[model samples]
Target: MGETDKHRRIMTALIEALIAFFKNIAGVYVSGNLMLYYEEGNPSACVSPDVFVIRGVGKNERRVYKLWEEVNAPDVVIEITSRSTRLEDLGNKRALYAELGVAEYFIYDPNQEYLKPPLQGYRLAQNDYAPIAPDAQGKFHSAILNLDLQIVNDNLRLFNPHTQKFLLTPLEAQEAVEQAETENARLRAELKKLREEK
Candidate 1:
């Protein structure tokens, strides 16, 4: 089954934001909706996550992600679940990620049509995945990325704990830049008026 437009948009937006966030970091690869082949020869053993981040791997383009080639599975896997993929994302994929030793697994339901809470996080514990407890405001923490996952106004957002701000999409980032420029212009004008008065 194909994903709805909203699902695709959310996946793209989140992936872009994560990539931009980690752009300066070395040995970090961020990908969206790419096929991850666990085994070298077996095509059947593969899954394409909505978004994945692998630390300690070269950030290069590849047709598929071969676990053996990289010598490591993705450190973090995020699935943007729709109604059709909800079960697989939460069940089979969850087990596969745990088995692969993925440190973190996250699921987000943009439409809230599948998951009860719409956002969930799991951490690998003792070779098994344990559910990550949400904070008081229902924000789940990601140990791998060191960020908070929150659902705000029916949208999934990543929050930087240290910066205490939400990571913005490319469009949102552009808007922020524009707003800052406008504010700076206003301040400059005010300063000019004050200097003239002096």
Candidate 2:
């Protein structure tokens, strides 16, 4: 494959992994770089979010997200910094998401070069992004998904507050479910013994 194709493939894999991680913990829809159509054939009107989450939406993979069809924009939009697109991601993209009524906006620097500290989060208030403070662990809480975002080992990870654990990918989640069932069975057997004694 060519250089551009290789890069796109790598990024696509990363995004898919991240989306699977988030979906396992929460009933939300995750999409990456799907075209948002604001105008026909208008280069300036096209906007694509690197990664976005929409709670309580379809769980199937989509080719392209049409705002008119979806009836609502994403609740949380994440942008991964790239050399060519850094300015657009931080400036115009931020404004576009805000104008579209996205509840949260997140940007991360995978290279950790340009935007020092690598991650920035904002919650929409009064039609604009309001900076959100990261927690002691340098994690930002997402108001839309009620999850936390943290950079762990150079990859952005999502933490589910409800479970008090970092969200897992589909495979991890399946393992977790199996583990939980085993524990429950063990507890049931113990309780049965106690009842027999009584």
How much RMSD separates candidate 1 from the native structure? 2.3
Name the TM-score of candidate 1.
0.89
| All models, RMSD in angstroms | 2.3, 5.6
For candidate 2, lDDT tens digit of each residue in 1-198? 122453354346446655766646655787776777765456467677777777766778787777767776788888877677779888988898899889999888777877867889999999999999999999999877777888887767778778898766455667889999999999999999999999
- How many clashes in candidate 2? 0
For model 2, what is the alpha-carbon lDDT of residue 139?
Answer: 95
**Residue 159 CA displacement from its true place in model 1, Å:** 0.4
The lDDT values for all models are: 0.89, 0.76
TM for every model, in the order presented, reads 0.89, 0.72
Tens-place lDDT digits, model 1, residues 46-148: 9898899999998898888888988978999989888788889888999999999999999998888779888988899998888899999999999889889
**Considering summed lDDT, which 10 consecutive residues are worst modelled in model 1?**
1-10
- Once superposed on the true structure, which residue ranges of model 2 sit more than 4 Å away at CA? 1-27, 40-44, 169-198
Lowest-sum lDDT 10-residue window in model 2: 1-10
